[model samples]
Target: MKRQQPAQIKGLKKWLDPVYSAWTSIATHKLRSSLTILGIVIGIAAVIALMSIGRGAQAQILSRIQGLGADLLGIRPGMTMAGGIRGGFGSASTLTLEDAEAIKEQVPYIAALAPTFSSYQQLVAGNQNMNAQVIGTAPEYMFLYNLEIADGDFFTDYDYQRGSRVAVLGANVKQTLFGDEPPVGQQMRIGGNIVRVVGVLKAKGAVWASPDDAVIIPLTAMQQMVTQPRTSRGERVVTSIALKVTDQNQIEFVTQQITDLLRSRHRLAPGADNDFNITSVQSTVEALKEATGTMTLFLSAVAAISLLVGGIGVMNIMLVSVLERTREIGILKALGARERDIWGQFLTESAFLTLTGGIIGVVVGCGVSVLLSRFKVMTTLLSADIIVLAVVVSLGVGLFFGFYPAWNASRLDPIEALRYE
Candidate 1:
């Protein structure tokens, strides 16, 4: 082992010579190297920026879906046909509190359920006023929608049954209406009627229905006190019913059960379309995931085309470098440099150039993402793994594109190279 050590050291030193030589060659051409590196830098930065938008959108969408609860289902009044033009979803209010009560009483495998009623109106508190969505729901609405009380308490069953004029303020609503003062027990006017604030909800960022900007009240209070009954749906109306299943596996079966029960109760003909729509939050999430993921990949592909362009720049510059260094290659070959050594030297230079650019590109991409996020254009994210991946891809791109130039140099005849210029 001791006798073999010196031979191993000699071999290692011989291998390292090409690496240092390649780096020296790259360092000597600062202007040319910088321009080549800039191409890769722009390509990588574009990739990071575009990918972040897709990923950020995906994250926000998933959060909103999760806020609805994992096993939650929404049963909304379906479209309405008027004057031969079909109105869109939520255009009708065929759902009722009785329907919710019936589902509560009859449905099994249900973990939670609530009646949803809502209208958008400007709420007034003293001299302050802000337009917000007024939501009328049951006691379960807080837990069902993943809400947490920041101050007082949510309306109880007694409040709903007695049709009490009590309200729960959302974070933004509280800020706009009450400012820094304690909001609990304060009176606020909705639809011109004074209602006492009972609780304030913790900050929940932009949700699907903009619930963070809503004032929550009891269903009975909303029905009896403030708003008039809609001429089309009349009294005893609800916008939708939200339910949570006891088990994830039982979701489809329970949804089917609810569907059949609703049809049977409504006494619909076999072929008649139901006036309501049932939607699973999980299904919505999966569908959104697929859509956003596909869009991300497509945009990423478009951005990645820039990387190929950058690679071509690397190849072009490397070919020029080879042409300029023909006499140097001949001198090295005459001094006992092998074809593989010449190949390795150029390949190493290419890898170093792209790798350095990749590191700088990551920083530039992150900076661009932060700026974009500041402007609220879209969101971006960076992970350690993504950074590492960009570097690996950059190095691979450099190696693949730099190969032909290196090979051409390695195959040149020593006599011909030495005689040139």
Candidate 2:
């Protein structure tokens, strides 16, 4: 045991000596070392900041999509191709109220559904005038969309059957037209037709499909006031239909059943495309998430180009370092230091420089992210895992870029280096 003690101490010194020598060399050339580290700092900070913004955007979009409920399904008119040109989705007036009724009666596991249409119209209340989206839907729309009434009541089935000219105001519409005054019982003109305001909806902030900026009226009332095309069988064309599945697990099955029924009703051949499209809310959410993820990866890759530039800077600085310390390397080699020792020392020096820069970059990046979120300039999400990844990548870059210079330093001939003035 006593004889082995000296050998263990020698082995420990072999590792610690290189680290100490590397630190001493770096400390001796503070200005040059700092300049080299600046490149790494900029690269890391850019990567972290851009990644945080991407992640935050993805989260916000997902939250808005999921707000509509996971068990919801939407049916909309498909695209139309005319003269070899394809129009955008929802451009064709293919869906109808009869199709919605058929789905309601035929499809199983459907808790509720509503046929609806919308158009932007000019609204006038007393002396106030503004343009807002006007939605025509059945009485079941309230339940399907999870809307709540803050004043008065939503129109009833009797009003819908009678084609009553009553309307419901969204929070923004009411505030704009009445401004602190109660909107119920007041009259508003929609497209030059006078309609009575029977109810007001609660405020639901900004969302993808929120009715906060829209007005709701019975479908029959809108059909009478607006000139819309009808099917050959006298069915009124509708914009879209919203369906609520009774069970989240049954969404796929319900979608399939609706598709088969609609295809049969439209008399579409087996090889032909249906005139309508059915999209489940869950599927839409997944698609959006995937798109956002791809965008984030693309932006991160662009930012990584700067890291590569920083690695090149590391290589350049290490090469200059090898040239400046050639005589010192010769003295160490003559004093019994091995080539591996010289290699390890230079590699340690390069790693230390990058590792220091990475820590500072993380601090700067986090501060910038917090400031952006604080001032509402943009949203940002910084996770610990990303920080760890940035640091590890910086270390790996140092080792990779430092290889050639370290090898050149280790292979120097003692006589040649000693004579190199």
The per-candidate count of clashes, in order, stands at 0, 0
The reply for model 2, stretches above 4 Å from the true place, is 1-17, 335-338
Which digits, one per residue and each the tens of the lDDT, describe model 2 over residues 1-421?
A: 4655588789998888877888899889899889888888888887788888888889888888787788889999888899989888888778899999999999999999999988899999989999999999999899887889999999999989999999999999999998999989999999989999999999877467889999999998998889867877778789999999999999889988988998898788998987888888788889999998897888789778988898899899999999999999999899987999889889998988887888887887778877988999988889998799989988998899888899999999998887778
Q: Write the per-residue lDDT of candidate 1 for residues 84-161, one digit (tens) a residue.
A: 899998776677777788889998999989987888878999899988889888988887878889999999999988
Which window of ten consecutive residues has the lowest lDDT sum in model 2? 1-10
| Residue pairs of candidate 1 with colliding backbone atoms | none
